[model samples]
Target: MIDATHDTNGTRYKLFSFMTHDVFGHGQYVKHALMENEGSECLTDAVTSFKYVNPTWEKVRVIIVEKGFGDISLL
Candidate 1:
């Protein structure tokens, strides 16, 4: 999926997207965060269970993920 500025002719996102919160809301309508090595490590580590993403997955909303999946593909 492509996230950028200036809407072009056409674009689309995946069935499920991987995005993080921009606490400060620095720029654009959508402020998505990139994956970090620390997060990747956390995802892989057995002791680490989950990370709460307040922006995308609001406090009331809930989704399950595998131990190391930053993205989801049930199909």
Candidate 2:
């Protein structure tokens, strides 16, 4: 969720929210139909809550990914 007022500083924040489901598992036993293959499948098969998109505040381009937060560049 992108929010302009979640903090007292009046700064904008973005949260890319998504969900995952694995009926069998993510290993050899997992079925291809049950894995998270596409965005539409997840949004359509979820028990509740459809896809959500938060408003854009400041655009950013992800440069790197790590265990935690990684490098990014403002657009």
lDDT per residue for candidate 1 within 1-75, as digits (tens), equals: 212222322443222233333457442222233222223342233112222323333342334344654423321
TM-score versus the correct structure, for each prediction: 0.20, 0.17
Q: Name model 2 segments beyond 4 Å from true.
A: 1-10, 24-75
Q: State the C-alpha lDDT per candidate.
A: 0.31, 0.26
- Tens digit of lDDT per residue, candidate 2, span 12-73? 33222332223463322111123232244442442123222313312322222233322122
- The CA lDDT at 46 in model 2 is 29
* Model 1 lDDT at residue 66: 42
